[model samples]
Target chain A: MPVLEVDHLSKDFGKGRVVDDISFHVEAGEIVGLLGPNGAGKSTTIHMLLGFIDPTAGTIRIFGKSLRRNREDIFARLNMASPYAGFPNRLTVFENLMIYARLYGVAERAAKIRNLLGRLGIEELETKQMLELSFGEIARVRLAKAFLNDPQLLLLDEALGGLDPYAATLAKDVLTQLQREHGTAILYTSHNMVDVEEMCSRVIFLRRGRIIAMGGPTEVTRAILREDRKKPALSEAFIHASRGEPHAVE
Target chain B: MRLNRIAAVIERHVYDAKHNLERVTDTLYWPVMDIIVWGFLTLFLARHGNLRPGLISFLLGAAILWGMFRAFQRDLAVSFLAEVWSHNVIGLLATPLTLREYLSGLLAINLLKAIVGTAAAALVALLFYSYDFFPYLIALLPFIFVLMIFGLAVGILVTGLIVRYTTKIQSFTWSITGLIMPFSCVFYPVSALPGWMQPLALALPTTQAFEGLRQVVAGGGFSWERLWAGLALDGVYLLAAVASFDALFRSARVRGLLVRIE
Candidate 1:
């Protein structure tokens, strides 16, 4: 069975639907990229999957258990890391990690904090408060937090938003390693297509809250090129697809 | 299940506060300043007349209680506001951390701030003013417990307002808490108030705390009626605050206002 199964999930905001009927699946050890431009409902879909927002209709299951009924159980095995999620500013980096580790109910918190800090190459900066860290370090600390529980299913919402090219590449390698070594199923979101093309095994294209395309990145890119002579790059393919261009339908 | 979640949140706040020692001090600083400045000013004003030894002591005790209360309200409201201002609330929302967890964590932090602030005020009063610490110290725990609950209720109400309305209201919380004066009977005996003002002043939960503290410290016995009244009134306020928080959070989720800073 797939590690995650999202079935016809829909969420409405006020009078309009922000995340329309959407469905997908992720097998263990698979890295899936949720790609979309701003306001494409990528975050909304992720939020619903994480049980942050209730769906207007449909079901989501993790490890074959219903998310609605077993959210705490599912959440115990799952974790999300994003720099955008606020950490207490006055707390030191060590303190921030320790707090999350405890919340995730990680045993032997001291060792866990030390191991994760070392893993993230942030051991030296442990004592520094969060406000003192550079943006890149903060991003890396968030990444550390996500994997703190040794999560089986990791949802990374714009996980690499602030990293430089080298750091972003290192993060990608870490994600790849996490999957290969631990069988972690990752749902990655990013605007950077090159990273998506390199890191993801499969791609899900969202346009105004609907999944427009899903397949291997190479296969989708090739198909888009074959169908649209005007656009050559995957970025252009994304815009063309979102605009309801006729070529994207195929 | 509900209790488990609440405990999880409380644990998170304890952890956060433990690592962030600077924040605890930062939270208590302004309130400490309020005590130093206002405590002296009230003394100076009352010195010209008969400063009832018991009344003056009551005023000092009320200042200490009020300081802790403001410390809690300001700290919790500002902590939540800081998250909102920095645009990080949305990020926390995406995690397994529920709204209740977030609110509970902040509330715990506020409670801790009240304890620390009260302690600091007592220490300072002891060292600087040659004040008798025994009665004040004995009354400290119960006084702070009631005052913290009252402060938390105000904090939740203010936080709910901040989430739904503009952040401009955040500044008003401290000023209004300071303004809870005449009703609290911080400066004079409740009996000294005009006939009609007596019931009105006595209705405030903090007034009961002031009266009870004086009865215990100077009058030589604990006032059961005042203690129970304070707890009951403050309990109702806390329930109202929690209800308002629930409503605000539900509307915020629908309007997407919880994560919106401006």
Candidate 2:
């Protein structure tokens, strides 16, 4: 069974529809990229999946339970990391993690927090306040918090954004190792096409609140350049696809 | 509704208070200052024999009770504001912590602040004016409970508005109780208000509480009827506040304000 399933999700904000009818699922141990430009409803979709926003229509099922009916049960098996949201600025890194650990009811919390700090290579940042940490450090600490519960499914919304190349690479590596070791499913969103190409086994492209395309990176890349015979980068294809341009010759 | 989740939220705020000296000082400053300032005024009035008998006790009691009300109101609103300022609301809502648990945690925080502020104010009152509020503890309990419920109700309503509207109306968090204080008749009898305002003053639970406090300080017969009336009114206000909070919360979710509100 898929670890995450979103079916026919739609959200209307009275001004207009922000997320039109959309559907997708993430299987265990799979990394799926949600690719889109800004305002393409990537964040909106993630928000819905996390139950932050109530969908005007459709359903979300996690671990075979309806999200609307069994939110706590579903949330117990999933966690999310975002560069947009943050921990309390006044709290030290360790304090932030400890609080989240207790909230999620993680047993052996001290040992788990210590292990996550070491795993994320943020042991030195334990005492640092969130406001004092660099953007990269904040992202790393958030990732550590996300992994605190050993979530079965992880929703990463632009989790790699704002990091330097080295930090991004380190984050990606840790995510990969964590996924492999724990068989955690990840629904990763990013504008970094290179990271998407390297890490995502399958990509779901959204544009104007609709999925323009979905498939393996190689398959979608081939589909994007099928008629042109020129193997443009995923970023180029993404730009073209987002513009509603045809990938194949008629 | 989970104990661990509620404790976790409270723990975060406690840690925040521990780390932020400004927050600690802000909580302590008002009650202590009010006592000192009012204590001196009462002393001068008594020294000159300018005040009526029992007026000093009245002033000190009002100050301490008002401090309790303010503490409850401010702590609840600040708890919500803290989440907004830190951009932690999204993270919190995304977790298993339900809105009910979140409010419970805020109430728990308010209780802690109420205890500290009330005790500090009471202690200052005892030392500065020789006014002992402790003997009236049993009488004050219901009054304090009514004030707390009303304050919490207002705090929830204000927090809900701030969440739905973002920081545009954020000033309501602290200013709202001040706006209600006049109607509450904290320092005077409801009859002292203008004839036009008496009905409105009588409608407030705080008015009933303060009036009851005055009666207790005057050594008059305690009015159980007044306490019951205040509690019943508080129940109505509490229900309305919870409804307002729920409505605003739903609207916030629908508008995607929770994630977008900084």
Candidate 3:
């Protein structure tokens, strides 16, 4: 069964629609990429999934429960992480994660925080205040917090944007391991086409507030490159998606 | 509404207070300073005229209670502001924590801070000025309760506005209490205001609370009518504030205002 199902969801700000009737689902252990250029409504979709904003139309169900009606229950089973958000500047990394651990109702909080930090290769940061860390280190802390609950469904919005190449690779590894071990479904959005192609089992491409393409990375590339004999990279498909040219619908 | 979630938020705030010097000074240092400055002024006045007995008790008690009002109001506002400033509000909202659980934690922390700050100030007064507020506490409990409730209500209202209107809401944190101080007659009687302002002042629960505080300070027992009136106003104001917060929160979510907290 799908861990998350967002059906015909739409969002408008005043006269401007941001996410227009986009729908998708993430089954357990599947990592679905939400790919879009700037203002293509990827973040808006994530915001709606997190229940940070209300959708103008349609519904979002997680674990077969309505997000509007069972937000707390659904939220407890899921988590979101973004590089744009940080821990309290005055708090140590451990202190910050401890609060989330309790809020997420994770048992064995110490073990979880320690293990997560170790897995993220930032265990030394446990005693450091947020203000004392670099943006990349803080990104790792966010990952620790996001996965501390052992979330069944995870939403990641540019969550790996600030990490270095090595850290990003490690972070991606940790994500897939969690998915493989615990069947944690993930919905991810990032501008890094290479990362998305590598990590996502399937991709959803959005342009001007709607999904323009949805399929496996290779299939999506092939779909966008229809009628052309040359197979192309995901980045090439990204360029085509951004150019707003007509492409074969998948 | 859940205890564990609420405790989690409070735990964050406690860690915040424990680590941040500014927050530490807010709960301890500033209250101590208020008592020290005001304690000296009362002595200066006592040397001038035949002051009412327990006059030090009166002024210091007012200061202590008023400090608590500020504590309740400012702590809630500032605590929420801390999250906004650190860009951590989204991190919190993304958790399993409900709105009721979040606000309950902040208010619970406010209550704890008010009690601790009030006690600290009172302790200084007892040690230095030899003025004990405990004797008057039972008599003044109802009035103090009203004032604290009003303070928390204002905090909630200001927080909602901040959530709705993003920038410049920080001004409300510092200036709101100052704006309400005169109308509250914090240092004076309601009759001290002009006749037109008297009715306006009396409409404030803080004004009534202070009046009752003064009555008890002068050895006059509190009037049931005034206490009930203050509580009624507090109830209405509290309900309105809660409703406004709920509406503003929903509107903010609809408009994606929460994501703009930073």
Candidate 4:
């Protein structure tokens, strides 16, 4: 069974449908990238899947259980991170980690926080408040938070933003390692084509709240390249795809 | 069928508060300042003999109630705005926690603040005034509920506006209660309102709360009738606020309004 299933999910706030009949599935040990332009409803679609917002139409199932009915069950095994999400600025990096670890109900929370910080090469930053840490450090803390629960399914929404290349690589490698070790299903969202293409096995493209394309990297690439094999890079493909260009906008 | 989600919501909020102690303390500055300012004012009034002993009791009650109510309202607004500001609301939603749990957790935190703020205010008032702070204090617990529910109701109403429209109106929501001090008869009886506006005074929650406080202080014993009235009104207002909250969230989702703020 799929770890996460979004079936014809639609959300309408006022006049327009931001998430219009979008459907997709994420299986165990697989990483899926949700790619789109700035206002493409990618976030809205994810919000619905999480049960943060009620769907105007359709349903979401997690681990083959209705999201509405089995929210706590689904949430216990789920964790998410976004670089844009702010950790409490008043708390030290270690303190922030410890708080989340406790919320996850992890045993020996203090030890777990220490291990995660050490693993992230952020032991030196443990005493510094979040606002005092550099952007890259904050990003690492957020990434650490995402995995605090040893989540079975991890959601990353632009999780690499604000990280230096080295930090970004480390964060991505950790995610990849977790997928291998825990069979953690990952829903990765980013505008960075290189990272998405490199990390995700499957990709789903969204535009103004609708999925314009989906499949393996090669399949999606082929769809983007269409008749031309020697086309521009993936970033160009993303731009062309979202712009409704003749070759990639299908 | 699982209620664990509710506990999870509470856990997350308390966790966040614990982790963000600095920011939480910074946020409490306004209420703390409110106590200091009013604490001195009550002292000055008492010294001048202008604040009759009966009025001093009324003022002490109002000081505590205002602190709790304002804390409830401010915390709700700031917490929601903080999530909105950081784009974290999206992340939270992706969790198993529903909006209902999220809201209930916020309300719970506000209740905690109400208790602590009420205690601190009582201590400070004791230092500055000569009233039996504890005798009438049992009534303060329910008083906190009255203030918290009303504050939360207003907070939800404002949050609905924020999710759809500009949150510039949030300032208005926070300070609007300040007007309640004078008109709600926080420092005096509603009868003091010119013969023309007693009905207007009755419309405010503070009127009944003060009357209840006075009844307890005068040894009239607890007034079941007044307390029930306040609870009934709180229930009505809270329901209305929740309705607005639901409608606004739906409208925002449909219109993609969530993205507008983020």
Q: Which pairs, if any, clash in model 3?
A: none
Any runs in candidate 4 off by more than 4 Å, and if so which? Answer: A9-21, A36-41, A52-58, A206-212, A228-244, A248-250, B1-53, B79-87, B97-116, B139-145, B155-166, B194-196, B258-262
Task: Return whichever of 1 and 2 wins on lDDT.
Answer: 2
Residue A137 of model 1 has an lDDT of 87
Total backbone clashes of candidate 1, pairs 3 or more residues apart or in separate chains: 1
Ranking by lDDT: 3, 2, 1, 4
In every candidate, how many clashes are there? 1, 0, 0, 7
**Residue B121 error, candidate 4, Å:** 3.9
Colliding residue pairs in candidate 1: A85-B91
Native contacts kept, each candidate: 0.29, 0.79, 0.83, 0.30
Candidate 4 lDDT? 0.73
Error of 2 at B246 (Å): 0.6
What's model 3's lDDT at B1?
67
In model 4, pairs of residues that clash are: A12-B254, A13-B251, A13-B253, A13-B254, A13-B255, A14-B254, A14-B255
- The docking category that best describes candidate 4 is acceptable
* lDDT digits (tens) for residues A91-154 of candidate 4: 5777667655654667787788788777777888988877788877887888888888889888
Q: Once superposed on the true structure, which residue ranges of model 2 sit more than 4 Å away at CA? A: A228-232, A247-250
Q: Give the TM-score of candidate 2.
A: 0.95
Q: How much lDDT does candidate 1 score?
A: 0.74
The C-alpha stretches of model 3 lying farther than 4 A from their native spots are A228-232, B50-56
Give the better candidate number (2 or 3) by lDDT: 3
User: What is each candidate's DockQ, to 2 decimals?
Assistant: 0.30, 0.77, 0.78, 0.29
Residue B129 lDDT (model 4):
56
| Predicted candidate 3 versus true structure: per-residue lDDT over B1-262, tens digit per residue | 6799999999999999889888877888778899999999998888887566766776888888888898789888888889889888889888879978998898888788788888899999999988888988899999989998899899999898888887577789878988888899877888789898998898999988988888888888777887998999999999999999989989999999888776
- Deviation of model 2 at A55, angstroms: 2.2
Q: Give all candidate RMSDs, comma-separated.
A: 4.2, 2.1, 1.8, 4.2
